[model samples]
Target: MKQVNVFLCLTVTFQMKWLINHGKNSWGIHSMSKNLDIMVKHLTRVEGHGNIVVNMKDGVLEKAQLDIVEAPRYFEAMLKGRSFHEAAIITSRICGICSLGHQMTSLKATEDALGLEISTQTELLRKLLIHGATIQSNILHIYFLVAPDLLGAPSVFPLIPTHKDVILRALRMKRMANDIGDIVSGRAVHPITPVPGGFTQIPSVGELKEIRRQLVEDGIPDMMETVKTLASVAHMIPNFTRETEYISLKHPDEYALYDGDIFSSDTGPAPDSDYLKMTNEFVVTHSTSKHCKHSRSSYMVGALARWNNNYKQLCENALKAADSLGLKPNCNNPYMNTIAQAVEVQHCIENAISIIDTLLDRGLKDEKPNQEPTRYGKGVGSNEVPRGILYHEYEYDRKGNIIAANCIIPTGQNLGNIDDDMKKLVPEIVDRPKEEITLHLEMLVRAYDPCISCSVHFLDVTFVE
Candidate 1:
């Protein structure tokens, strides 16, 4: 057996040098040779609990999978028999990080079921809220979660001494993003102002102007620095590629974060109502979260998917940022999902400024929510959340109470894709040292930024004789 070479670098700068010199070659052509069994009990730096399990015997690959260890949360069951007004508020509690996304998607579903038509101002405000949520979530993942891996540290805490400026910059950017959420949606975590139809209270012109000014003076500049920082360490990312189907929401006018029709890389556009066909979710014994497949054995839905489908709609500066970050259109590499998210942070900053300008020009309105139901029936709502395309479906009665509800989380849709990537990835790196192979697997899992807790809401029970 050939002993895999390992480099020990202490500082961020030396780590980059090591990555440039040896990292790429480590992942070069190699044949599987060793018999191994690996299990990561609980992966770190992600939202929820999950384990990576792999077993190999006599050079024959046996099993490679991501075990979703988190227990079911029963969010769907909790939604049954709830009123339309309480739907968004209750579902928003599903994820603290993605609460705004859930709230928006839930409102869209509720509004669709109850026939509530929002005004132009309401739509603009919601879009701004989404932009803020995206900015916040992306920044959190890039800096707090994935940066430690690229920088050769166990966690972000160790990088404080060497990368003080970088840490400070991350904090500043996150704070600004949170401020946008606080001002627009009421609070950063679970938004309070937004409802089924419109906001309980509109933001003042002065508040919008201040946010616009800060984004211009600080947010854009910070994003530019973020790109440079990531570019310096981009070589640390693995150079693995596997072409698969990419799925996301696509709109003709914008980047498709707030609203759009369902789009697939393998196939063309489909109405949002056909999400069930696109996401054929099934039971997987290893996971409480149901796995999804569409057009193939598996597909991906998230930042990279949106980039592949909607790169043309990105702002000019965001396109330039993508080029600088090595995130090209039609990218097959899953590791570049982090880079795609960085590009989105840039776009969200610029787009947020534009949205604020539009809102200020139109002036703020203290209009009450339109709760009148023209017709009560079934409705579906879809939005491109920070992780991926999140769908919510509800059936309501004439009295505005929910009879049934279904939610398809993005992480759940990407589980099968993650497992498939592992099967291909493990063999390529099986010859390397145990530690190195383990790190690669962890990085691959983190690349998708899976929200395991969010995905475990669904569970299938069987009663056998």
Candidate 2:
């Protein structure tokens, strides 16, 4: 066994060397040796466990896939027989990073199923909370996960010594964003105040004004610095593009975060009720997380998708930030997702301030939640979370107990697209060093800002005939 292992290692080494020498073709063309294997057992700096597996033999691409190794969380099954009141609370545990997103989406599903109507004030506050969540999550991704690659560091830890100011700015922005969630939603990680119909607690007028002041005095300046920082390292982002469908929630009045219809860049708008049709989820042998495709083999559903589908809805400041960061509309490069996230940080800050001003003008309302259900049946809810568009569907009985549930996280939707990108990217960059190739693959996966644990809800069942 030892001798065989040695022979295998030597063969792989020789093949890599040969590829480095011979493989160099024009971009997007398979001009490499196409004889390599990469098994990143557990990728790092992302929210959950995922592996990048690629194999090419004899100039034919064999397999390129992001294998989700995380066990199935079964959040859907957990919701069965649960009460409408507990749905959001339970589903929010799916991810700590995206807990607020899950909570809000779950609440939307519950309210829709129970025919609960929320007040206008409730809508405004929820939008504020969403903006906070988006800001927090996007800033976290931009600084903690992706910055290390661009700055030539192993992780944010190493940069602490050299890039202390940059790191400090990241922490300050994150703290401010979390403060918004904490004040409005009752906590940042797993919000406690927001319920099916409305918030259990409302921020005072003083609190709203304070948040607005902080946004203007601190958030805006920090965001400007962030854009400059990202722009400095923008050249490090890979220049790769594979045109594919982009999907996100599209709102008519503003950039869709709290709610919108399902919009696809390829086929245009579809009702949120037709999400299953838009997703077209199917199982793949390579991944435990079910893959989704619509209007193509795969479609992306994160910041870049939102930018492509809803760029016109962005405020003027966000548009300027995009221009500064070189994030143009209709961008197909997956790496630009990080850039898009930065742009969103700017948007969320600006939007959050506007929401606060509106709330202040309307005066604080201490209205109780409307829990009286007119009906109970099927409903669906979706939001463009930090990672991408998240979905929750539920059916409730007359007694308000959940009968069935399904959740489609953005990470699951992006898995197939990541795989597709890998197939194209590996061939295009196969001539580079193996380490460089592996780094590119890792960066590509990180570009999606995937939350693997949130996505691994697929369970395969077989029956004995």
Candidate 3:
């Protein structure tokens, strides 16, 4: 075996190609190397419970797979017989990192079933609360979970030694966002402000006035500083890019975070009702996440894809800031996912400010709850999550109980893409020592910035010689 002349794993925004992938929790191997063919009973990288099997027959790479091993939970399948309202709150337990995304998805599904429409003031409040929720989640991902790699630290905990103040600021920012979410969401970790008719409770004028000012004036600026901090570090890597079709929920009026029609570069636009016509899912035996193919091929969704798809809709300041960082439309680099997060933090801040101004000036509009749909109807609810595009499909009863529920989370959507990436990335480093392979894999996960456990968990690798 010939070793590469030089190899360096630099965390600080290493070279990223256009190809961004998601987190995978498992692996499988089928070798035609005439050496060994072992079926992986389970695949994952969590707790280091998996290993890549490489077969070489006279200098030819025959078979390779990095596997994950973790217990799988069927969350969607378990929602049967649950009332729409009950299921809405219960499903929030799916991912600690994906609270607000699931909440709105669940709310929309239930509201559609119930035929309910809320007041304009309520709508504004809903958007504000969700944005606040995203602010918290994004900050957590950018600073607590993601910044360590860009700074070459092992994890957020270790950064305390030298980056204490930065981490503290990030934490406070995250905490403030979560605190706003908690006030509306009931507890922040799993919110319940939304319901079939409207909110379980509404915020007082004093409360709205106070939180709005803080988020726009105080929290937003802090978020910008964090964005600048991350963007300053995004150019270190130049080799992590790969080309893939970017897919997202597109809204013509604004950046599509809360709700919009499903769209892709390949498929122009599909009504929410027609989403099933395009998205297809096949369960992978090796992994819990249902590997998805857009029109039968893997595609991407989430922060980066959303940013790219709706780059034109960005608020002026955010658009200028992203342009300043050299983030163009249709960015294919996975490492730039961090940059997308930075841009969104700014956009969310701007969006929040403008929303407050609109409401404060025009005053809040009032409307009644939607009349319940008597017939069983099906509709899909989709929006950009802090992680990516989240989809919820429901079959409802006349009484507004969820007779059937289906969710295609961002993590599941990225499974096929992640596996494809490993297949391509591993050969580039298979000859390296075991430690080198491990480092590369870790960086791969970090690059995705995935809420993998949003639907599933991380990979567990166990290498077999």
Candidate 4:
């Protein structure tokens, strides 16, 4: 009992020291002689790079700038002349992490242009594939990427030594989840199996049976254990109970992932067409990414929002697991997102299992293959990516060539909230040393799981002049 107290005390001391390492300066430092502006480009150590600049006035945050300097891939520009089938492939390459979500949206758009509605068998398969993507992305976000900071581990690699079994199970499960997405969507990174009308290739009975077998054999057990373990780790983070308005897709019958109506804490079910109206974005001089404000103001989405909006839609197994940890719908604590991600994984496996079983029950082992559809018209599509709502609007000429395209990425939609979060976060964490500010800012963005790399991506940090 005495040892526990010592450990607790030490943890608190370390947190305090980290938070105030950067001295408080109400005014930023500046040199005279025309205030030389140094062009210091922040080198991003992660896979995607963005930049942030801060002007400090006597140690106070005078200005913070975020930029996605990376040239916007002329993706939208490139889509003008491709076939609908080809455009789907091109769009899928936009984000490595969210390739499947893009695939589903682009395909749905193509189907709209062609006026095709697919079979239930195909729809169920798509649901399984996309849900697998969600599980894969969410688990990656929760365990390896997000948990390290909250638990005070520099990286997942370090945790392996102290918590070998727990970390290994998480890695293995995340790999398996990605594999499930790969099988149905095409590949884990960028799959082409989904087509404008349906899948380029349908699954064989044997293949689906194998997927089903593993769904129960390994998926549920791994996820259930994950929820139990991560919940324990989450209790250690400092000041994690900040409440924010939650937003996500809502379905009447189930927790919406791939298909559902939109819902949020501040509003009831919104028609799909009303999405853009709700997420009104405006530009800010300090950053290149468009800032978003909801109908009322800024709001947040992703796993936490979805879980809160649709907790009642969760299956029995998932609800029991979440409730075991004292989690419920309308959970406002943003820090609870990782737990929500884990809980959603449990629910995803269950949903996939149900979908597979439904397909198998039809008695028609393997369904028909995808062929170009005869229908043609304009269409809009949406699916929930790991981060938030992803929308696609497509137009085609009578000959089946693409004419216009619009895609609203989840990361883009979350920009306003991301900015607002930093507004609150910088002051909370800025008391720490200047060098440590970057790490704290990184944590804030990681919490939102932003995936965009601008031609010159925007990053925010307080800097001295």
lDDT of 3 by residue, 46-83 (tens): 44244444443332345544344444444555666677
| Candidate 1 Cα outliers beyond 4 Å, as residue runs | 1-33, 44-49, 452-465
lDDT of 4 by residue, 1-465 (tens): 000110110010000001222443431212111121111244243332344544444434444544434434556677877787697788887777788888887887777667777877778888888778888887777777777776777667888889888788777777777767667766778886777657667667777788878878888888778877766765654343455667688887778887787786786778666766656655444443454567644788788888878888888888887887666676755556666777888888998888988888885434444446676566778788777777777778877777777777666666556555655565555555555656655655566666523211233343444
Of the pair 2 and 4, which is ahead by TM-score? Answer: 2
lDDT: the better of candidates 1 and 4: 1
Candidate 1, residues 1-465, lDDT tens digits: the string is 111000000000000000112223333324334467776543422333344556665555565655444335566777778998899999888778788988999999999888899999999999999999899888988998889888888767888899999999999898899889899889989999999889888888888888888899989999999999999999999999998899999999999999999999999899999988999877654444567799998999899999999999999999999998889899999999999999999899999998998888877778999888899998999999988999888889988988888888887787778777876787777787777887787787678876533222111111111
**Candidate 4 Cα errors over 4 Å, as ranges:** 1-48, 52-60, 240-243, 324-326, 364-375, 429-438, 452-465
> What is candidate 2's lDDT per residue for 340-413, written digit by digit as tens?
99888888899998889888888898999999999999989888888888888899999999988888888778
Deviating ranges (above 4 Å) for candidate 3 = 1-66, 362-374, 428-437, 452-465
In order of appearance, the predictions have TM-scores of 0.90, 0.90, 0.82, 0.82
Task: Find the 10 residues in a row with the least total lDDT in model 4.
Answer: 8-17
Give the Cα error of residue 102 in candidate 2, in Å. Answer: 0.7
C-alpha lDDT of candidate 3 relative to the true structure: 0.62
Which should have the higher lDDT, number 2 or number 3?
2
